[model samples]
Target: MYRHSATPRPYTTVVLAMSTDGKIADVARSPARFSSKSDRTHLETQIALADGVLFGASTLRAYGTTLGISNPQLLQLRQQGGVPPQPVQIVCSGSANLDPQMRFFRQQVPRWLLTTTAGATSWQKEQALGVGSFERILVADTSTGGIDWNNAFQQFFQLGVGRLAILGGGELVAALLAADLIDEFWLTVCPLILGGRTAPTPVEGEGFLSTLARSLELLSVQTIEQEVFLHYRLQRS
Candidate 1:
Protein backbone atom coordinates (compact mmCIF):
# COMPACT_ATOMS: atom_id res chain seq x y z
CA MET A 1 0.00 0.00 0.00
CA TYR A 2 1.22 3.48 -0.73
CA ARG A 3 1.70 5.51 2.36
CA HIS A 4 -1.11 8.00 2.57
CA SER A 5 -0.35 11.65 3.17
CA ALA A 6 -1.17 12.73 6.71
CA THR A 7 -4.24 14.51 5.41
CA PRO A 8 -4.88 11.67 2.95
CA ARG A 9 -5.53 14.30 0.33
CA PRO A 10 -3.42 14.02 -2.73
CA TYR A 11 -5.25 14.66 -5.99
CA THR A 12 -8.37 12.49 -5.68
CA THR A 13 -9.71 11.00 -8.89
CA VAL A 14 -12.58 9.19 -10.60
CA VAL A 15 -11.56 7.96 -14.06
CA LEU A 16 -14.98 6.85 -15.24
CA ALA A 17 -15.19 5.14 -18.61
CA MET A 18 -16.81 2.67 -20.96
CA SER A 19 -13.76 1.76 -22.91
CA THR A 20 -13.07 -1.55 -24.51
CA ASP A 21 -9.56 -2.86 -25.11
CA GLY A 22 -8.48 -0.76 -22.13
CA LYS A 23 -8.37 2.32 -24.35
CA ILE A 24 -10.09 5.61 -23.61
CA ALA A 25 -10.90 6.15 -27.24
CA ASP A 26 -12.06 3.77 -29.92
CA VAL A 27 -9.10 4.74 -32.04
CA ALA A 28 -6.78 7.66 -32.55
CA ARG A 29 -8.97 8.48 -35.53
CA SER A 30 -11.76 10.10 -33.54
CA PRO A 31 -13.26 11.18 -30.22
CA ALA A 32 -13.98 8.49 -27.61
CA ARG A 33 -17.58 7.81 -26.80
CA PHE A 34 -19.05 6.10 -23.74
CA SER A 35 -20.98 2.93 -24.64
CA SER A 36 -22.65 2.06 -21.37
CA LYS A 37 -25.36 3.68 -19.29
CA SER A 38 -23.84 2.19 -16.18
CA ASP A 39 -20.52 3.84 -16.94
CA ARG A 40 -22.14 7.24 -17.39
CA THR A 41 -24.06 6.75 -14.16
CA HIS A 42 -20.85 5.86 -12.40
CA LEU A 43 -19.30 9.13 -13.57
CA GLU A 44 -22.28 11.13 -12.40
CA THR A 45 -22.11 9.44 -9.02
CA GLN A 46 -18.47 10.37 -8.61
CA ILE A 47 -19.13 13.98 -9.59
CA ALA A 48 -21.72 14.21 -6.86
CA LEU A 49 -19.18 13.14 -4.28
CA ALA A 50 -16.48 15.62 -5.16
CA ASP A 51 -15.89 19.13 -3.86
CA GLY A 52 -14.50 20.06 -7.28
CA VAL A 53 -14.33 18.52 -10.74
CA LEU A 54 -11.42 19.17 -13.11
CA PHE A 55 -10.28 18.34 -16.64
CA GLY A 56 -8.57 19.82 -19.66
CA ALA A 57 -10.37 22.38 -21.77
CA SER A 58 -9.93 20.27 -24.86
CA THR A 59 -11.79 17.50 -23.09
CA LEU A 60 -14.40 20.05 -22.14
CA ARG A 61 -14.87 21.06 -25.78
CA ALA A 62 -14.75 17.44 -26.98
CA TYR A 63 -17.13 16.10 -24.36
CA GLY A 64 -19.29 19.26 -24.27
CA THR A 65 -19.56 18.67 -20.53
CA THR A 66 -21.82 20.86 -18.42
CA LEU A 67 -21.04 19.89 -14.85
CA GLY A 68 -24.35 19.59 -13.03
CA ILE A 69 -26.30 16.88 -11.30
CA SER A 70 -29.23 15.63 -13.36
CA ASN A 71 -31.53 14.56 -10.60
CA PRO A 72 -33.09 17.78 -9.43
CA GLN A 73 -34.53 16.26 -6.26
CA LEU A 74 -31.21 14.80 -5.25
CA LEU A 75 -29.41 18.01 -6.06
CA GLN A 76 -31.84 19.97 -3.96
CA LEU A 77 -31.36 17.55 -1.10
CA ARG A 78 -27.58 17.81 -1.37
CA GLN A 79 -27.84 21.57 -1.41
CA GLN A 80 -30.05 21.40 1.67
CA GLY A 81 -27.55 19.12 3.30
CA GLY A 82 -24.86 21.80 2.96
CA VAL A 83 -22.99 19.90 0.28
CA PRO A 84 -23.17 22.96 -2.02
CA PRO A 85 -25.32 23.09 -5.10
CA GLN A 86 -22.51 22.16 -7.42
CA PRO A 87 -18.84 21.24 -7.30
CA VAL A 88 -16.43 23.81 -8.68
CA GLN A 89 -15.89 22.86 -12.29
CA ILE A 90 -12.22 23.43 -13.08
CA VAL A 91 -10.36 23.43 -16.37
CA CYS A 92 -6.66 23.62 -17.23
CA SER A 93 -5.64 25.23 -20.46
CA GLY A 94 -2.59 27.28 -21.29
CA SER A 95 -4.73 29.59 -23.34
CA ALA A 96 -7.92 30.76 -21.72
CA ASN A 97 -11.12 29.70 -23.47
CA LEU A 98 -13.82 31.76 -21.90
CA ASP A 99 -17.11 30.80 -23.49
CA PRO A 100 -19.57 32.60 -21.31
CA GLN A 101 -22.59 31.36 -23.20
CA MET A 102 -21.76 27.72 -22.58
CA ARG A 103 -24.13 26.03 -20.14
CA PHE A 104 -21.30 25.50 -17.65
CA PHE A 105 -20.65 29.19 -17.56
CA ARG A 106 -24.36 29.98 -17.34
CA GLN A 107 -24.64 27.95 -14.15
CA GLN A 108 -24.45 29.71 -10.79
CA VAL A 109 -21.43 27.74 -9.63
CA PRO A 110 -18.12 29.30 -10.58
CA ARG A 111 -15.50 27.72 -12.84
CA TRP A 112 -11.73 28.01 -12.61
CA LEU A 113 -9.53 28.39 -15.65
CA LEU A 114 -5.93 27.60 -14.76
CA THR A 115 -4.05 29.15 -17.62
CA THR A 116 -0.41 29.81 -18.45
CA THR A 117 -0.96 32.71 -20.84
CA ALA A 118 -3.74 35.21 -21.55
CA GLY A 119 -3.96 34.17 -25.18
CA ALA A 120 -7.68 34.14 -25.97
CA THR A 121 -9.66 31.07 -26.98
CA SER A 122 -11.59 30.64 -30.23
CA TRP A 123 -14.75 31.25 -28.28
CA GLN A 124 -13.28 34.26 -26.59
CA LYS A 125 -12.05 35.54 -29.92
CA GLU A 126 -15.64 35.66 -31.10
CA GLN A 127 -17.10 36.87 -27.82
CA ALA A 128 -15.72 37.49 -24.32
CA LEU A 129 -16.97 36.56 -20.86
CA GLY A 130 -19.38 39.46 -20.25
CA VAL A 131 -20.26 38.48 -16.71
CA GLY A 132 -19.46 36.42 -13.64
CA SER A 133 -16.19 36.40 -11.72
CA PHE A 134 -14.84 33.10 -13.11
CA GLU A 135 -11.32 32.66 -11.87
CA ARG A 136 -8.43 33.00 -14.28
CA ILE A 137 -5.41 31.66 -12.41
CA LEU A 138 -1.99 32.25 -13.92
CA VAL A 139 0.58 29.72 -12.85
CA ALA A 140 3.87 31.07 -11.44
CA ASP A 141 6.02 28.94 -13.68
CA THR A 142 5.70 28.70 -17.44
CA SER A 143 8.62 26.30 -17.61
CA THR A 144 6.18 23.38 -17.51
CA GLY A 145 3.91 25.42 -19.85
CA GLY A 146 0.78 23.56 -18.72
CA ILE A 147 -1.20 23.08 -15.58
CA ASP A 148 1.09 21.80 -12.86
CA TRP A 149 -0.88 19.28 -10.81
CA ASN A 150 1.03 20.08 -7.63
CA ASN A 151 0.66 23.81 -8.14
CA ALA A 152 -2.98 23.41 -9.09
CA PHE A 153 -3.57 21.38 -5.92
CA GLN A 154 -2.11 24.18 -3.83
CA GLN A 155 -4.64 26.46 -5.49
CA PHE A 156 -7.37 23.94 -4.74
CA PHE A 157 -6.28 23.82 -1.12
CA GLN A 158 -6.66 27.57 -0.95
CA LEU A 159 -10.14 27.32 -2.40
CA GLY A 160 -11.16 24.89 0.36
CA VAL A 161 -11.48 21.93 -2.00
CA GLY A 162 -10.99 18.81 0.08
CA ARG A 163 -11.78 16.18 -2.56
CA LEU A 164 -11.75 16.24 -6.32
CA ALA A 165 -13.16 14.11 -9.14
CA ILE A 166 -11.27 14.21 -12.36
CA LEU A 167 -12.47 13.67 -15.93
CA GLY A 168 -9.60 13.69 -18.36
CA GLY A 169 -8.72 13.47 -21.99
CA GLY A 170 -5.68 11.22 -22.53
CA GLU A 171 -3.02 13.92 -22.26
CA LEU A 172 -4.25 15.25 -18.93
CA VAL A 173 -4.65 11.72 -17.58
CA ALA A 174 -1.12 10.93 -18.67
CA ALA A 175 0.12 14.03 -16.88
CA LEU A 176 -1.64 13.05 -13.66
CA LEU A 177 -0.30 9.51 -13.87
CA ALA A 178 3.21 10.81 -14.42
CA ALA A 179 2.95 13.23 -11.52
CA ASP A 180 1.74 10.42 -9.23
CA LEU A 181 -1.01 12.85 -8.36
CA ILE A 182 -4.06 10.69 -8.82
CA ASP A 183 -5.45 8.98 -5.72
CA GLU A 184 -7.65 6.34 -7.39
CA PHE A 185 -8.21 5.12 -10.90
CA TRP A 186 -11.75 4.05 -11.81
CA LEU A 187 -11.81 2.52 -15.25
CA THR A 188 -14.82 0.90 -16.88
CA VAL A 189 -13.46 -1.01 -19.81
CA CYS A 190 -16.20 -1.71 -22.34
CA PRO A 191 -16.63 -4.85 -24.48
CA LEU A 192 -15.66 -3.41 -27.81
CA ILE A 193 -12.60 -3.96 -29.96
CA LEU A 194 -11.08 -0.78 -31.27
CA GLY A 195 -8.04 -1.58 -33.34
CA GLY A 196 -6.31 1.69 -33.97
CA ARG A 197 -2.87 1.58 -35.55
CA THR A 198 -1.98 4.56 -33.35
CA ALA A 199 -4.07 5.51 -30.32
CA PRO A 200 -3.77 6.75 -26.77
CA THR A 201 -4.05 4.44 -23.75
CA PRO A 202 -5.29 5.12 -20.24
CA VAL A 203 -2.00 6.87 -19.46
CA GLU A 204 1.08 7.89 -21.41
CA GLY A 205 4.69 9.20 -21.17
CA GLU A 206 7.44 8.52 -18.58
CA GLY A 207 5.81 10.72 -15.99
CA PHE A 208 3.47 9.92 -13.03
CA LEU A 209 4.33 7.10 -10.61
CA SER A 210 5.24 4.71 -13.40
CA THR A 211 8.93 4.46 -12.47
CA LEU A 212 7.78 2.83 -9.25
CA ALA A 213 5.28 0.32 -10.58
CA ARG A 214 4.51 -0.54 -7.00
CA SER A 215 3.35 3.02 -6.44
CA LEU A 216 -0.01 2.11 -7.85
CA GLU A 217 -1.28 -1.29 -6.75
CA LEU A 218 -4.51 -2.95 -7.68
CA LEU A 219 -7.02 -2.78 -4.91
CA SER A 220 -10.17 -4.37 -6.37
CA VAL A 221 -11.57 -5.72 -9.61
CA GLN A 222 -15.15 -6.28 -10.58
CA THR A 223 -17.15 -7.01 -13.70
CA ILE A 224 -20.68 -5.79 -13.67
CA GLU A 225 -22.29 -7.29 -16.72
CA GLN A 226 -19.93 -6.86 -19.70
CA GLU A 227 -17.99 -3.90 -18.28
CA VAL A 228 -15.00 -4.15 -15.98
CA PHE A 229 -14.23 -1.52 -13.34
CA LEU A 230 -10.67 -1.67 -12.13
CA HIS A 231 -9.76 0.25 -8.98
CA TYR A 232 -6.16 0.87 -7.98
CA ARG A 233 -4.37 2.59 -5.14
CA LEU A 234 -1.02 4.36 -5.10
CA GLN A 235 1.34 1.98 -3.37
CA ARG A 236 4.41 3.05 -1.44
CA SER A 237 7.63 1.05 -1.37
Candidate 2:
Protein backbone atom coordinates (compact mmCIF):
# COMPACT_ATOMS: atom_id res chain seq x y z
CA MET A 1 0.00 0.00 0.00
CA TYR A 2 1.19 3.52 -0.72
CA ARG A 3 1.81 5.56 2.39
CA HIS A 4 2.06 9.32 2.72
CA SER A 5 4.50 11.39 4.76
CA ALA A 6 3.72 12.85 8.19
CA THR A 7 1.54 15.58 6.66
CA PRO A 8 -2.03 14.72 7.60
CA ARG A 9 -4.69 14.43 4.94
CA PRO A 10 -8.40 14.71 5.49
CA TYR A 11 -10.18 12.13 7.64
CA THR A 12 -11.90 10.50 4.69
CA THR A 13 -15.21 8.67 5.06
CA VAL A 14 -17.21 7.03 2.28
CA VAL A 15 -21.00 7.38 2.45
CA LEU A 16 -23.07 5.10 0.25
CA ALA A 17 -26.56 3.61 0.02
CA MET A 18 -26.68 0.20 -1.59
CA SER A 19 -29.33 -2.44 -2.09
CA THR A 20 -29.53 -5.60 -0.02
CA ASP A 21 -27.61 -7.38 -2.75
CA GLY A 22 -24.76 -4.82 -2.42
CA LYS A 23 -25.54 -2.90 -5.58
CA ILE A 24 -25.38 0.86 -5.57
CA ALA A 25 -27.06 1.23 -8.93
CA ASP A 26 -28.88 -1.09 -11.28
CA VAL A 27 -27.52 -2.54 -14.50
CA ALA A 28 -28.81 0.50 -16.37
CA ARG A 29 -26.72 2.68 -14.03
CA SER A 30 -29.44 5.31 -13.81
CA PRO A 31 -29.87 7.58 -10.83
CA ALA A 32 -30.59 5.26 -7.90
CA ARG A 33 -33.83 6.38 -6.27
CA PHE A 34 -34.61 3.13 -4.45
CA SER A 35 -33.44 4.37 -1.10
CA SER A 36 -36.07 5.99 1.14
CA LYS A 37 -36.33 9.62 2.15
CA SER A 38 -34.76 8.63 5.44
CA ASP A 39 -31.71 7.49 3.57
CA ARG A 40 -31.57 10.86 1.83
CA THR A 41 -31.64 12.57 5.20
CA HIS A 42 -28.90 10.25 6.41
CA LEU A 43 -26.81 11.18 3.41
CA GLU A 44 -27.35 14.88 3.96
CA THR A 45 -26.34 14.46 7.61
CA GLN A 46 -23.10 12.85 6.51
CA ILE A 47 -22.48 15.59 3.95
CA ALA A 48 -23.12 18.21 6.59
CA LEU A 49 -20.28 16.82 8.67
CA ALA A 50 -17.64 17.01 5.98
CA ASP A 51 -15.44 19.90 4.93
CA GLY A 52 -15.68 18.65 1.35
CA VAL A 53 -17.53 15.91 -0.53
CA LEU A 54 -15.72 13.98 -3.27
CA PHE A 55 -17.38 12.01 -6.06
CA GLY A 56 -16.45 10.74 -9.51
CA ALA A 57 -17.49 11.70 -13.01
CA SER A 58 -19.67 8.65 -13.61
CA THR A 59 -21.58 9.39 -10.42
CA LEU A 60 -22.11 12.96 -11.52
CA ARG A 61 -23.34 11.69 -14.86
CA ALA A 62 -25.75 9.27 -13.21
CA TYR A 63 -27.21 12.06 -11.09
CA GLY A 64 -26.59 15.45 -12.55
CA THR A 65 -27.30 17.11 -9.22
CA THR A 66 -25.14 16.74 -6.13
CA LEU A 67 -26.74 16.53 -2.71
CA GLY A 68 -26.57 19.60 -0.54
CA ILE A 69 -27.55 20.17 3.09
CA SER A 70 -31.08 21.59 3.07
CA ASN A 71 -32.15 20.74 6.57
CA PRO A 72 -32.39 23.97 8.49
CA GLN A 73 -30.90 22.47 11.64
CA LEU A 74 -27.93 21.15 9.71
CA LEU A 75 -27.38 24.54 8.12
CA GLN A 76 -27.53 26.16 11.55
CA LEU A 77 -24.99 23.74 12.92
CA ARG A 78 -22.57 24.59 10.15
CA GLN A 79 -22.93 28.27 10.95
CA GLN A 80 -22.24 27.55 14.61
CA GLY A 81 -19.12 25.64 13.58
CA GLY A 82 -17.87 28.68 11.64
CA VAL A 83 -17.92 26.85 8.29
CA PRO A 84 -19.83 27.66 5.14
CA PRO A 85 -23.48 26.69 4.78
CA GLN A 86 -22.50 23.96 2.36
CA PRO A 87 -19.34 21.93 2.07
CA VAL A 88 -17.21 22.06 -1.06
CA GLN A 89 -18.35 19.67 -3.76
CA ILE A 90 -15.40 18.16 -5.61
CA VAL A 91 -15.69 16.16 -8.80
CA CYS A 92 -12.83 13.78 -9.64
CA SER A 93 -12.39 12.83 -13.25
CA GLY A 94 -9.44 11.77 -15.39
CA SER A 95 -10.66 13.19 -18.67
CA ALA A 96 -12.87 16.02 -17.34
CA ASN A 97 -15.44 15.34 -19.99
CA LEU A 98 -18.31 16.75 -17.95
CA ASP A 99 -21.38 18.54 -19.25
CA PRO A 100 -21.21 22.27 -18.82
CA GLN A 101 -24.99 22.33 -18.52
CA MET A 102 -25.30 19.78 -15.71
CA ARG A 103 -27.42 20.99 -12.82
CA PHE A 104 -24.38 20.56 -10.60
CA PHE A 105 -22.78 23.68 -12.05
CA ARG A 106 -25.77 25.78 -10.99
CA GLN A 107 -25.95 24.49 -7.44
CA GLN A 108 -25.27 27.11 -4.79
CA VAL A 109 -22.24 25.44 -3.28
CA PRO A 110 -18.49 25.68 -3.58
CA ARG A 111 -17.38 23.57 -6.53
CA TRP A 112 -13.93 22.17 -7.35
CA LEU A 113 -12.40 19.70 -9.76
CA LEU A 114 -9.59 17.20 -9.41
CA THR A 115 -8.24 16.06 -12.75
CA THR A 116 -5.13 15.48 -14.88
CA THR A 117 -2.99 18.04 -16.69
CA ALA A 118 -4.64 17.20 -19.98
CA GLY A 119 -8.06 17.42 -18.39
CA ALA A 120 -7.25 20.75 -16.76
CA THR A 121 -6.06 22.20 -20.02
CA SER A 122 -9.32 21.36 -21.74
CA TRP A 123 -11.44 22.60 -18.84
CA GLN A 124 -9.37 25.77 -18.55
CA LYS A 125 -10.20 26.54 -22.17
CA GLU A 126 -13.86 26.11 -21.31
CA GLN A 127 -13.34 28.49 -18.39
CA ALA A 128 -11.88 31.10 -20.71
CA LEU A 129 -15.02 30.74 -22.77
CA GLY A 130 -17.07 31.45 -19.61
CA VAL A 131 -18.62 28.00 -19.45
CA GLY A 132 -16.63 26.46 -16.58
CA SER A 133 -17.80 26.55 -12.95
CA PHE A 134 -15.07 24.90 -10.88
CA GLU A 135 -13.58 27.38 -8.42
CA ARG A 136 -10.33 25.43 -8.36
CA ILE A 137 -8.92 22.78 -10.64
CA LEU A 138 -6.30 20.52 -9.04
CA VAL A 139 -4.10 18.42 -11.29
CA ALA A 140 -2.48 15.33 -9.77
CA ASP A 141 -1.95 12.61 -12.29
CA THR A 142 0.42 9.64 -12.34
CA SER A 143 2.59 8.71 -15.33
CA THR A 144 0.26 5.81 -16.09
CA GLY A 145 -2.73 8.12 -16.68
CA GLY A 146 -4.14 7.51 -13.22
CA ILE A 147 -4.65 9.80 -10.27
CA ASP A 148 -1.94 10.13 -7.63
CA TRP A 149 -4.02 9.47 -4.53
CA ASN A 150 -1.37 10.58 -2.04
CA ASN A 151 -0.70 13.82 -3.89
CA ALA A 152 -4.39 14.56 -4.27
CA PHE A 153 -5.08 14.05 -0.59
CA GLN A 154 -2.11 16.23 0.37
CA GLN A 155 -3.59 19.00 -1.73
CA PHE A 156 -6.95 18.43 -0.10
CA PHE A 157 -5.30 18.86 3.30
CA GLN A 158 -3.54 22.02 2.17
CA LEU A 159 -6.94 23.44 1.23
CA GLY A 160 -8.05 23.09 4.89
CA VAL A 161 -10.22 20.07 4.26
CA GLY A 162 -9.83 18.32 7.61
CA ARG A 163 -12.83 16.07 6.96
CA LEU A 164 -13.80 14.67 3.58
CA ALA A 165 -16.79 12.60 2.53
CA ILE A 166 -16.57 10.33 -0.48
CA LEU A 167 -19.74 9.89 -2.49
CA GLY A 168 -18.85 7.24 -5.00
CA GLY A 169 -19.64 5.46 -8.20
CA GLY A 170 -17.47 2.46 -7.15
CA GLU A 171 -14.25 3.04 -9.13
CA LEU A 172 -13.32 6.10 -7.08
CA VAL A 173 -13.87 4.19 -3.84
CA ALA A 174 -11.82 1.28 -5.11
CA ALA A 175 -8.87 3.50 -5.98
CA LEU A 176 -8.91 5.20 -2.58
CA LEU A 177 -9.27 1.85 -0.85
CA ALA A 178 -6.31 0.42 -2.75
CA ALA A 179 -4.28 3.41 -1.59
CA ASP A 180 -5.41 2.79 2.02
CA LEU A 181 -6.60 6.38 2.20
CA ILE A 182 -10.23 5.85 3.23
CA ASP A 183 -10.79 5.87 6.96
CA GLU A 184 -14.41 4.85 7.52
CA PHE A 185 -17.70 4.05 5.80
CA TRP A 186 -21.36 4.87 6.37
CA LEU A 187 -23.28 2.27 4.41
CA THR A 188 -27.06 2.17 4.18
CA VAL A 189 -28.48 -1.10 2.96
CA CYS A 190 -31.96 -0.64 1.54
CA PRO A 191 -34.62 -3.35 1.24
CA LEU A 192 -34.17 -4.14 -2.41
CA ILE A 193 -32.25 -6.46 -4.68
CA LEU A 194 -30.47 -5.09 -7.73
CA GLY A 195 -29.02 -8.35 -8.95
CA GLY A 196 -27.14 -7.97 -12.20
CA ARG A 197 -23.55 -8.65 -13.13
CA THR A 198 -23.23 -5.19 -14.63
CA ALA A 199 -24.69 -3.41 -11.62
CA PRO A 200 -22.36 -1.12 -9.69
CA THR A 201 -21.38 -1.75 -6.07
CA PRO A 202 -19.78 0.33 -3.35
CA VAL A 203 -16.33 -0.84 -4.41
CA GLU A 204 -15.49 -1.80 -7.96
CA GLY A 205 -12.26 -2.38 -9.81
CA GLU A 206 -10.19 -5.48 -10.42
CA GLY A 207 -11.47 -7.83 -7.74
CA PHE A 208 -9.07 -8.33 -4.87
CA LEU A 209 -7.73 -11.72 -3.91
CA SER A 210 -8.81 -12.94 -0.50
CA THR A 211 -5.28 -12.60 0.81
CA LEU A 212 -5.09 -9.00 -0.26
CA ALA A 213 -8.65 -7.90 0.43
CA ARG A 214 -9.03 -5.09 2.92
CA SER A 215 -10.87 -5.72 6.19
CA LEU A 216 -13.33 -3.55 8.04
CA GLU A 217 -14.17 -3.39 11.74
CA LEU A 218 -17.86 -2.92 12.24
CA LEU A 219 -18.37 0.19 14.31
CA SER A 220 -22.16 0.24 14.58
CA VAL A 221 -25.36 -0.96 12.95
CA GLN A 222 -28.92 0.33 13.19
CA THR A 223 -32.15 -0.89 11.71
CA ILE A 224 -34.38 1.97 10.72
CA GLU A 225 -37.62 0.70 9.23
CA GLN A 226 -36.49 -1.85 6.63
CA GLU A 227 -33.15 -0.18 5.96
CA VAL A 228 -29.97 -1.16 7.71
CA PHE A 229 -27.44 1.54 8.49
CA LEU A 230 -23.94 0.22 9.02
CA HIS A 231 -20.82 2.02 10.15
CA TYR A 232 -17.37 0.53 9.74
CA ARG A 233 -13.75 1.50 10.10
CA LEU A 234 -11.19 0.24 7.62
CA GLN A 235 -8.81 -2.17 9.37
CA ARG A 236 -5.25 -1.22 8.57
CA SER A 237 -2.41 -3.65 9.04
Clashes of each: 8, 0
- Model 2 is weakest, by summed lDDT over 10 consecutive residues, at 1-10
Candidate 2: residue 175 Cα off by (Å): 0.3
lDDT of 1 by residue, 37-65 (tens): 77777777778877888887766776555
Query: Alpha carbon lDDT of residue 21, candidate 1?
Result: 62
**Which candidate tops lDDT?**
2
- Candidate 2 per-residue lDDT over residues 1-237, each given as its tens digit: 123447678999999999999999999998999999989999999999999999999999989989999999999999999999999999999899999889999999999999999999888888888875999999999999878988999999889898999999799999999887999999999999999999999999997999898999999999999999999998876
TM per candidate comes to: 0.80, 0.97
Q: How many backbone clashes are present in model 1?
A: 8
Query: What local lDDT does model 1 show for residue 175?
Result: 74
Candidate 1 pairs with clashing backbones: 2-235, 2-236, 19-190, 177-208, 178-207, 178-208, 179-208, 215-235
RMSD of each: 3.8, 2.0
Q: List the residue pairs that clash in candidate 2.
A: none
lDDT of 1: 0.67
What ranges in model 2 sit over 4 Å off? 1-5
